[model samples]
Target chain A: MMILGPAHASPENIATMRELMGLDHSIPVQFIHYMGQLLKGDLGYSYHAGSPVSQELLRRFPATFELTTFAFVLMVLCSLPLGVVSGYYRNKTPDNVISVFTVMGLSMPTFWFGLLLIYIFFYKLGLAPPPMGRLSPDVAFPPRVTGLLLVDTLLNGDLKAFLSAFHQLILPGVTLAFFNLAIIVRTLKADLIETLEEDYIRTARAMGIGVKKVLLRHAFRNALLPTVTMIGAIYGSLLGGAVLTEVVFSWPGVGMYAVQSIRYLDYAGLQGFIIFYVIIFALITLLVDISYRWIDPRVQLD
Target chain B: MKEVLLEIRNLQTHFKTDEGEARAVNGVDLKVPKGETLGLVGESGCGKSVTALSIMRLVPEPPGRIIGGEIIFDGQDILKLREAEMRRMRGNTLSMIFQEPMTAMNPVYRIGSQMAEVIQLHQKVSKKEAMDRALDMLHKVGIPDPKQRLREYPHQISGGMRQRVLIAMALSSHPKMVIADEPTTALDVTIQAQILDLMNQLKEEMGTSNLLITHDLGVIFEMAQWVAVMYAGKIVEYAAVSDLFSQPLHPYTTGLMNSIPQIDQPVPKDKMLRSIPGMVPSLFDLLEGCTFQDRCNHVFDRCRREEPGLADLGSGHMVRCWLHG
Candidate 1:
């Protein structure tokens, strides 16, 4: 508010700001005004967006949500099985091969990888249509149901739009997933290997529990506790990584909206996105905590 | 006549380390009758625990090879059995209570869940039925409020409680034999006595045979019917506990008795405690003569030149020393 206000230092503007903040009155008065405004659903207008704060947020939120979810699904599909196999085979060829790929994914920057992917798939192979808006202009977009393009397309029973949307999503989502896949795989592998070496795992073996059961039941759940924290951290981390992905793919999502807000100095849009993500990251962290307790009975917070 | 549940004949478990083969359990021969308690007494690294692992087939393969000998357990040569068949026999026919109860049980799981899993693996029972059996075993092991206690995790309970829980789980399947590897060593004196008393009472009530492995002579004297004194991975003396203690034929066995603090004999405070000098020989070094020869005070030319086979003079007394002839 201070940065964008042209007459922020002017005596009149300063007085007006102070009155709006209720600073001219008592401290309790200002707190009440803040609470009242928050409760009513008035987020205040955007000098940059030029639309109601909520409407602009509502408009940009779907795009970001759609992109992140796609990337998350991609991460899970690749990392989980790879991690299991790597830990199971451990020092063998399978582990070696997976380790190589994981190292490659981890070492390469996500933005660099995104650009590389765009160059290969879009520019060279010409497999995907040149990365641009959510849907190509020639294809008529379906009626918005949930505001999520994929869901909206599916809801309208427009398979063509859904297929097209998915194809466009693949490169960006896979690129975003690369680094995350490396992280989850590394976490799962390290934890699983460590858990396997534990005396309980030896006890499990002594009790004649099968290797599969020992790995899946005895080791896997315990292994996932650390991975849950990793996932929660990634939930926030993905926001940053997604910016590069969104820019490269041109898929309209939170990251893309955020960059556009910063460039245009859309304070209301940027604030809305930031606040929305704080809530998101908090909720993800909460979910991780709950799941950790669910997975292992021994972890109890005093 | 009691039925012999296990007759381990000349069992030798060797680990092939980078240096050489380390025989953890070398040519150990013993027998335990059903419902009887046979105490295996040894110093650390003397193969008492290794023998227990061999009985359950829990020894790590590759580096650890049984080498030669037959672990005839429950009328089957466990060494000859396939991995799957051996696994089937482990919890149902033969179960083990490890020394460190804390590490023995999975900390992440509640005691009940782990116990129920062992029960369900062996029996085709419902989860509810398995849980009931777990609670029943917990009750038998003298745990208060078996149902509520079953829900408590290992860490939530004390070390003593964890041992009781492990004992309860081991006894749940009505295993023909239980191998306890220094089960009370980790507990304090009070808890140790409690666990020992509980084990004896439970064993008598269930009529389950036990292989009690420990270095504590006091515990061996208290609970063991037959005693086997192991030295350097070999049983130096094997006889009824009364006979073995009365006439300890092996020098190592006699030395061990002298080392244990006795209430009857009062020694001067400043006087050093009796100890058998010299460290246990490394497993990588093959014993050309007797493994205990270097440490034995009665070491003679024969003791240095040749190893002694377990020789029986009369009755059931057996000793592996040249002087025993």
Candidate 2:
């Protein structure tokens, strides 16, 4: 699993590193050489993985993608309404409690939270098994359909497969959710508070409309613009998927894969992950920029 | 003389502060006859705005509260009504035009939408009807190109146009009484005069009674038939405009009249306006006796120790100074 660091580099790696990093050559020449290599679908072989880096990434990608997607859904489900109420009752007891919890969530290390969850939920409560691997070893997996375990299992019509996959995912999903949820709730609460103070909300109240209508129609709609932007900026953090959480739970996601790759000086896999995140982040940021124009008419792109 | 439309009987409003309850509107009584303009004139912090707000029951509670008051309008006590009932009455039977035109309109909404919303809220009108009324109001206010301006934002319009739009919106529902709180304060001199002219014209056409609140005595002379001079949270003098101006009884009122710079008269060597001597008393640390004693140059032994009631002098004139006695 683990190999040596770049201290003892192969002749090929040395040449590539020199060319790419400009440790020994001009930037343009190195960029051209890098582009040529990249264009040929040659991501190079992983020293730790002992296979093509792309193939290794492809194998691990589904697991990380599934984890983050579930986490994102969980985050949204908890944050939006909670944030609204908390903001509506700002500085009140409920808001104060939520603030304290979010602060604790942000301060605690991901590893500690992940382990604590595993200890209580799995070890003590026995509601769930100690999370390890993507699916049960005994149950044979069908061919990947959408690269999502739950979806693929459902597509295969194997109820047993779906349940097994769902069970294993619950802990890791919650662990990942803690940090994202805290960030979203805090961001949304602040945004909603600012929106509540805007004159439109006061105008709505002055109209003698019900408070529910005032909040939903005026306050929340105005608050969502900033929330959308915050979500986009944080999309990159998902790919890196709570590294300590992955290690503690032993969920076979890209986070663990990336960590193992790094241990071995697996430059190919490391570069693959870095480049992958860069492209994904760039694409999401583009989506965020486009979204602002759609939601707020005043937002003009020069 | 017209019939009385609104009557305030012994109104008192207090504000809860760190020290104690600071009475902002102390036992003041006045009346507005139907279809007549009543000017509430005073210096800043004289609680003129508070009195206007109290009439509408829009005074902010906790810090601001109507401790004792009876705002009787349209044969009903508005202060005693439930919030929902008050909401129905407000903007339908009564409406107010706020001071700052710039902040009055919501920034996020188009003018048409906000205006239409107000119409629909009070009247069970269809959306189309609301839109038509909004457009009509816009046109009535003399906004250039009503259709184009309706879709535009508040910031897009000029200050004068914004004030007109506000006036239009306030009058759209044909409320019985309209309170214009320093409507022309935040405009240029030319814009101020234009707005004043427009308001006068609109008031005449609508035949709706207006309680115009302003510190500008010039505007009071032009628009108001009856004037009430407020000093330190109390109505120090009340009379017909001609009577009050010709023989002002309260020292505060006289001080205020002397402060007004006259362009028609020859400029004196000093050419300086005679301002009221001292600053207004802090509402928090209210004195035992007269609130105006510190500022009144004609203060006597009893003037500093005993607060005078608003005593009727003669005819319709009322004064609250020892000099009147």
Candidate 3:
């Protein structure tokens, strides 16, 4: 029904368009027909973009990858020390202060936080470039090397373009990282507190290991086991384009492509997006499973 | 008199629970002699473990703390040492073996790295040297194929093997004192004896003073040269092991000894197996006099009015009861 727009075209016109697109067949026939097309690596046609869905996905993949990678790196760098310190000195000053920010990070929606950053850094202070996409329209595109603008510009020895691209990434990257950081730290801190209570930790301390070794080597590694599962799940979503953060920053990533596909009733495009998400999610689950073996030997025993 | 190794004078450790401050170790005093095993026997929650932990200075703070008194170990006041000094002394001068061997080791680490880490911490040894020392310790503990055992995770080994690994870790530094808190409690009965035997053999070989805390009278009788019976966070009786058993004084001590199920001495058909009546008193609302007054069959007016101090009964036998005094 939504396939036809508000102009309310005649039934005859709808039938002709349907036949032209081969949608006139029964459901099973259409599925089998679509599978045959899929065998050739075709992800169907996107009426919304007027291009093949796979081509659109490939083009947007680099933008999403760069954004998620930056955000993930930021999350890891900030959360590990923050979580360990918060837990080691648990219920004390540093923990209390860190907890307050983490709670706020968890509470605020990604879209709202992204907008807030934009309001402060972009509108009020004029510190951020406009949230209008990857780069300013006036800047010439650097020669494609890695497909990530940050790397491609640096590869071309274009510092000016590198700075501009990095500026565009900052708000969204932070916005994406904040929520992920909140999850990881909360997980790590809680688990660390519990792990510290384990008999092994007390034994470790009694055996005269230094403060740093006891905390980091014994307690931290045990604590990180539970948090690894949380990180894997967060990673899969972040890799799938962090939908709300992408839309808020107007980063022309796969998430925007997905949103447009839905609004325009582009079923083929949506199907392709779902397929990509599942494949990435499966790979991430495998990585998490492998990590369990490395970090926790009892994984098999339990 | 053997030279004193570890002496505790009026050690008071308290825990802040929601109910109130739990006076876990209340005015406890005891001494361990060089190259001798002092068995600490008590009912569960009688501060035997707390006493052991206090000596290690590993009591969890905020909730648990050594609020008063001094612990002098090897001529140094343990409580007076700086944090760094205490750390150096740990696993070097003072080491501990915990109750639950199953959970006492880091499950994620190889037995080798975990043992090597403790050895390396107190000594300025390279990693390979530390590991060699670890391998030697494992061999000393009589673990079969010590080299291969070191590479295995804690769970891959049996509960008995884990306990042996713990013993190896505890003694790797040749500390001045080793506190074994029910080290074999979690293992099978057969394994328990083996572990205890291993500990005794090692203690004899190393001449490391041992503070063995256990609820089992038999274990105390077998392993300890001297025994201290604890009741409600204080030593109710202290004596040479043979003297304590032959003439068990403290009503609490007699009660514990009687409570042990006997195989050779059968109960009369009409008689029930003896057990101490009443529960250990709540540390939260401790009575004014003796903490055990409510549970003591020999309770009297003085016992209700004021607690008795441990009075020496000659030749190192002491009993904290009015009858003995």
Candidate 4:
């Protein structure tokens, strides 16, 4: 619709677009042709990029994947311990402080938060690298081993390049992760509080199990079920948030590519990006469902 | 007389609630002799469960607390012991079987792992050795196909089976005293009987003293040798189970016995089943005089003005009432 809607108005591309839209063939035939092309890994050409949409996607996707992966790791590492502490010391001073921070995190706009972080770390403190691209302007691109800049740099055995890449990643990675971390912590804390009240927790305590074992083995394991589901839900939206984050950081990722494609009326590039996002989201949902059974034996997958 | 395994002197446990301070266990004194079941019987909210939890030092803090008391078990004042020391005492010298077996054991873990964890927590044993002990305990609890049952989660088992597993876990360590808080309340009548029988048999086998908390007089009659009748957070009556049944001195005990339907003796068609009038007094607003005076039939001037203490009547039978005094 997007392609046809624009193509119908353009005088020059109209003839070629109509031919590509299968004006000579029946609708079912056109549908089948489209499916065949999709199945054969052909997403058509992006006129904006002056290349195939699939090739453009392949080039940009690794950056977004790497950024999202780093952000996700940061979210889990930061949120789990914070959530556990907050929930364990519920209604206390620490919990109150964390609650305020999380509320601010949840309410604050992602773009605004990204700008604020950049202002603090880059401008005020001058601790962070500039919000440019995935690597410094001066450094040449490392050998593409896994396509992740960090991995590729480390694999190339260039510690200096790896360190510089890591520095460039921190701001954007934290910007993408902060909101997700807040969400995870809040949900995890709520789940942990409920889990702590379960009769089995009392049973664990009654069995002379120490505080740490009771929290980690019994309470936290059970609490993680809901948090895992939350992660899957949050991860899909994180991609959406990544667009603004990428724009703010000026990071070369699929989100920025999609934004430029939309601005330039690159219909094929936009369609390809949507499809890829859906596929990744679906895969993550499947992984979360499988993890539920692992975390809670009572949850039967079948 | 048997040696005292657990001694409570003026034990008081209160809860700070929005309404007021709920005197859950108010200055209650009791004793459980070694290898004997001491039944603490009362209606709901009579502090039977609180007393049991107090003995285990498992009362939920902030809201519930032991204000003033000495719970001397195995020659140590548990209240005086540090948190770490108290933890060691739990599942080692003292273990507890909760009321609801269905939700008592963790649903996520297998029965064997939960049982084995308890063993490993208290004893210096390898995982394999602990697992072997768990299997042995499961067999002792009369669970069919013990090997398979050990690997199954709590939800996979029946209510009766879960209670049996709880019994096995509680007794696995052979603790000096086991606090069974209404252990058979959530089971069917037949299952209740089976569990009660198993507990009694296990108690005899292990020679472990039990502080059985229940509302059922029938359960007390079957399981307990020493009976403590509680009324609104105080032990209003203490006596041998047989003596208490034969000669209930406290008005509350009399009301309890009278309320129990006699199956063999047919009731008159016109007469309704006798129920104790009024309700258990709220612990939050306890009266200055007797806690049970509002419900007692034998209320007099002294009963309304001054509270009566537990008066000895003979043969170790005691009753807290103006009539007894």
Q: Point to the candidate with the largest DockQ.
A: 3
Total clashing pairs for each candidate: 3, 0, 0, 0
Could you give the candidate ranking by TM-score, starting with the highest?
3, 4, 1, 2
Question: Which digits, one per residue and each the tens of the lDDT, describe model 3 over residues B1-325?
Answer: 5999999999999999988899999999999999999999998998999999899888888789999999999998989999999988888878899999999999889999998888878888999999999999999998999999989999999989889999999999898789999988889999999998998988899899999999999999889999999988999999999999999998999999888878898785866678889999987778988778888999999998887899998999989998777
TM-score of chain B of 4: 0.98
Worst lDDT 10-window in candidate 3 chain A: A1-10
- Model 2's CAPRI class is acceptable
Per-candidate iRMSD: 1.6, 2.9, 0.7, 0.9
For model 1, residues B1-325, the per-residue Cα lDDT tens digits are 2688899999999988888888888899998988999999999999998899888887777668788899888788889999889888777878888888877778778888998998899999999999999988898888888889888888888889988988887777888898998999999999999999998998898888999999988899899888999988899899988998888989899989888887777885875468888888877776688888878888889887888999987777889999886
lDDT of 1 at B75: 88
> Stretches of candidate 1 above 4 Å error?
A1-58, A115-129, A142-145, A258-283, B1-3, B16-20, B268-272
- List model 3's recovered fraction of native interface contacts, to 2 decimals: 0.93
TM-scores, chain A, per candidate: 0.83, 0.87, 0.92, 0.89
After the best TM-score superposition of candidate 3, give how far the Cα of residue B270 lies from its true spot, in angstroms.
2.0
Q: How does each model score on lDDT?
A: 0.82, 0.81, 0.90, 0.87
Give fnat for candidates 1, 2 and onward, in order: 0.51, 0.14, 0.93, 0.72
Residue pairs clashing in model 2 are: none
Q: Alpha carbon lDDT of residue B217, candidate 2?
A: 90
What would you estimate as the lDDT of candidate 3? 0.90
Mark the regions of model 3 whose C-alpha exceeds 4 Å error after superposition.
Answer: A1-13, A35-41, A154-157, A300-302
RMSD of 3: 2.2
Q: TM-scores for all candidates? A: 0.86, 0.86, 0.95, 0.94
- After superposing candidate 2 on the true structure, give the runs of residues whose Cα lies further than 4 Å from its correct spot: A1-45, A51-62, A126-130, A133-142, A150-169, A190-203, B18-20
User: What is the Cα root-mean-square deviation between model 2 and the actual structure?
Assistant: 4.0
**Model 3 agreement with the true structure over A1-302: per-residue lDDT tens digits:** 46666576688878887996789899999999889988887889998898999999999989999999899889989999999999988889999999999999999999999999999999999999999888977788898888899999999999999988998898899999998798899899999989988999888988888778888999998999889888888888888767888889888898888998988989999998888887788889789988898898888723
